[model samples]
Target: MKITRKDFLRLSGLSFLAGGAMEAARAIAGRSSAATESQSTPVAQSVRWGMVVDLRRCQKEKGCTACTDACDAAHNVPRLADPQHQVNWIWTQPYETVFPFIQNGYAEQSDAGIPVPLLCNHCASPPCVHVCPTQATWKRADGIVMMDWHRCIGCRYCMAACPYGSRSFNWVDPRPAIAHINPDFPTRSKGVVEKCNFCEERLANGLKPSCVDACPQKALVFGNLADPNSEPRQLLRQRFAVQREPELGTGPSVYYLV
Candidate 1:
């Protein structure tokens, strides 16, 4: 339950506006939680972290769980045999179900039943943030929608607000279900709604998100969208990419190159 120096520095800066965050961090640490280290300072407009999924490369081979397994193991996501209690940070789903709008005649013309990876989009203006009465789920300086677990009351409001159905709530003690215990990150208890945070702690630690690093196919691309020279931005300029549901105008950071 050792708190990283990065988290110490982050709490030090936040001491002014929110003394509660410090106390919460202490409580989380006591629970053997991985405290999310915040940005040293407010991120400027030039830093908008985003990701790209090259669907062309994401096709799963037999017995392959490279990206999903790595992400869950790193984050301590649990596996529940109960279908109703299943929790997924990042996982593959049928293409038609993922992109329901492209249905019937539209979907049949394309990939059809192919499985596609999905996760939280970490939108530019996340509806979850707007609906959170406790402000538990809030966007960080770098275009990331992060959750303050301590502040989360487990009300599931964020889950209701998210149009993408990206959020998952804990129905039981999620810790016991974790097969691989990577102490680098903390595990969640029952009742809190959780989802992909875009691995903000890894970003602060000068590392890529576990999922991105673990991908065998190099299908996930993460970078600052504001940087025109970045790989994600460069790809966006050259290749055609589409959001999950652009009509909602959530301004999702993640794009899929189908």
Candidate 2:
């Protein structure tokens, strides 16, 4: 009998699966070379998100509510009756309230002094992401931390893990209070933890955050910290700054100028 090249090739191919012998051999030898060859490699995506808060430009005029209003309107956050249950994605913290020492020893006392706008710092080593049992919260490739509301089991472990108290638990449904909702943003359900996304929707659309845009004084600047050419990076380099709870080692993306 004469075997043609095609027939020979076919027989050779079948030889690998000839019997239980090959399977046992492959199992003992570890992953088959063919299986390894077929594996796909992971592709890396780049995103180095960061923020800058220019305190010098921030004015106490209107109590810095512009950023809060812009953020609430954009995200459809509800106004709650009780302070404990209240959900604030981005809120203002009075200078004296946040940093009491700044005014405690100083002879000057003024309520009109500029108050800092507080939000999720979106830390480089976010403890919230680490403590989430459901993997609902995670940091994006672009350095913005995000929450997957659907995947969230409402554990609220992230809340305790965050040192800055950036995470807010949705104690009640927020949709009822939303008179007008922005289609671009999704309203979060009750039971899940939510916080600032750095206006990730806007970022994905190639736009600055609502708070950044709403600032009359342009106090807030958002850009990539990795890029020295970026506005935030340049601003940080030019000015002395501080971050909230630096002792936690979260590597907070937001910087505050005194």
Candidate 3:
């Protein structure tokens, strides 16, 4: 029996997830397939934001909380302690699970705990937008997949449509779970689904995503995938990178270098 990539992601299991912010991102990515989209929009630039994760650098790191903590703090994401209801805007996964399509030697990457940071891919053709009855999740003009929390009906249809299992529902009020509240960030109420928005708010303010800023190992890179001179494009051209579940045709913007 072959343990396929989908099977690997299923086995990886996500126990925690955090709240809202991804709607704006989903709207952008949901508009087109990352590989095919022209990455055009009116209000936004001709930019397609993407990420690159270098396993070699990530391997040297031992702590997984840096990215997660920064994301939570920047976005006011809650720390749901309950295993049944924990929320994660960003988290870690084993290398084997992150790149299950690759075989044999890749397992070595998981030797010292792969702990690859995982988040919403902001796929060019995000399925989350397709299933959204209220257009809560849609692709933005700049090619980010975004979510409108006010528009979401808690249908979880987007969650089911997402092959990456990135979306998290608010089963309870998330305020009490927060250790420190960032007054600038908005909080999510119960019965809403939220995920990483690739820091749309920060981007609007001319800043990088919180996770990218906080990674001490410098394992993560963020840029406009459409720009040939962008860091992400340069890395993709020079290094061997792969996306999670490419077979699903989501055209994820996030790439991983092993």
Candidate 4:
């Protein structure tokens, strides 16, 4: 059997779990988990960050890539020419693909072809975090699912655990592929996983997510979902919204207002 490059990389990632490195990785994960719990406070747990995408508004501008472009620029996400190695923080999926449960005939005709932006849902119970043996991916106190690139073992367990297909593996060194690097953000090396973090770095600086900020239609709304007065919460109350695979019980924080 001829092993492809991708298969070789996958095998290498699995082989990395052997020997002294695996034990050291486990030790680091244990210590980090302990510190995370000890550092959590009431204020940190009070705010739950969420995003609401108004599909009605978003579809008005057909083929617009502003949100995705802004996200890539801000995060330094590589723009690899090959589809196999493309790295994206935010991108679009056909409406039908996003909501397979919606089988109404009229609804399908009207909305099925629309391009709905997709990203990590930042679930209340993130399977990616739970499956990461290195503690590389963990849910933050504020409900953000974070990736600690340094501790990532590239085992791809988190990728398998995420049903949304939100995670991307660094099949090669990503820096060189980036058209223009964003110095504010760090780049990833080969053998690591990456994904949208809800722009936690920007949030810490008191700014909205780059994607939300760049949406010309003002389709993306971000705020603390715990606050009833927040735009996302208010929208959820007034409009009909649905999450990606809500039945899976992951408690996705990203909602789409239909």
lDDT of all predictions: 0.84, 0.80, 0.84, 0.90
lDDT of 2 by residue, 88-107 (tens): 77787767665554565654
Supply every candidate's count of residue pairs whose N, Cα or C atoms clash at under 3 angstroms: 1, 1, 28, 0
lDDT of 1 by residue, 1-258 (tens): 898999998888788648787778887686433223342334557788999998888765534578888889888899998978988899878888777776767547568777787899999878998788876887887888899878899999889889888899999988888988888888888999999988888999999888999988888999998899999999899898989998998899999987
TM-score of 3: 0.80
Summarize candidate 4's per-residue lDDT along 58-168 as a digit string, tens digits.
998989999999999988898887888877789998988878888676778777789989999999888998788877998887889999999999999999999999999
Model 1 ranges off by over 4 Å:
1-44, 60-63, 103-110
The digit string of per-residue lDDT tens for model 3 on 1-258 reads 999998877665532121234655676676546523543344445688999998789778776678898999988888887867877788887766776667576456445356878999999878898788887888886677888888889989998999988999999999999899999988888999999999999999999999999999988999998889999999999999999999888889999987
Q: What is the C-alpha RMSD of each candidate to the true structure, in Å?
A: 12.1, 10.9, 15.5, 9.3
TM-score for candidate 1, residues paired by index: 0.80
Rank by lDDT, highest first.
4, 1, 3, 2
In terms of TM-score, the best-performing candidate is 4
Q: What is the lDDT of residue 57 in candidate 1?
A: 82
Which of 3 and 4 is ahead in lDDT?
4
After superposition, the stretches of candidate 4 with alpha carbons farther than 4 Å from their true spots are 1-44
- Worst lDDT run of 10 residues, candidate 4, spans 37-46
- Identify the leading candidate in terms of lDDT: 4
- TM-score, cand. 4 vs. native: 0.84
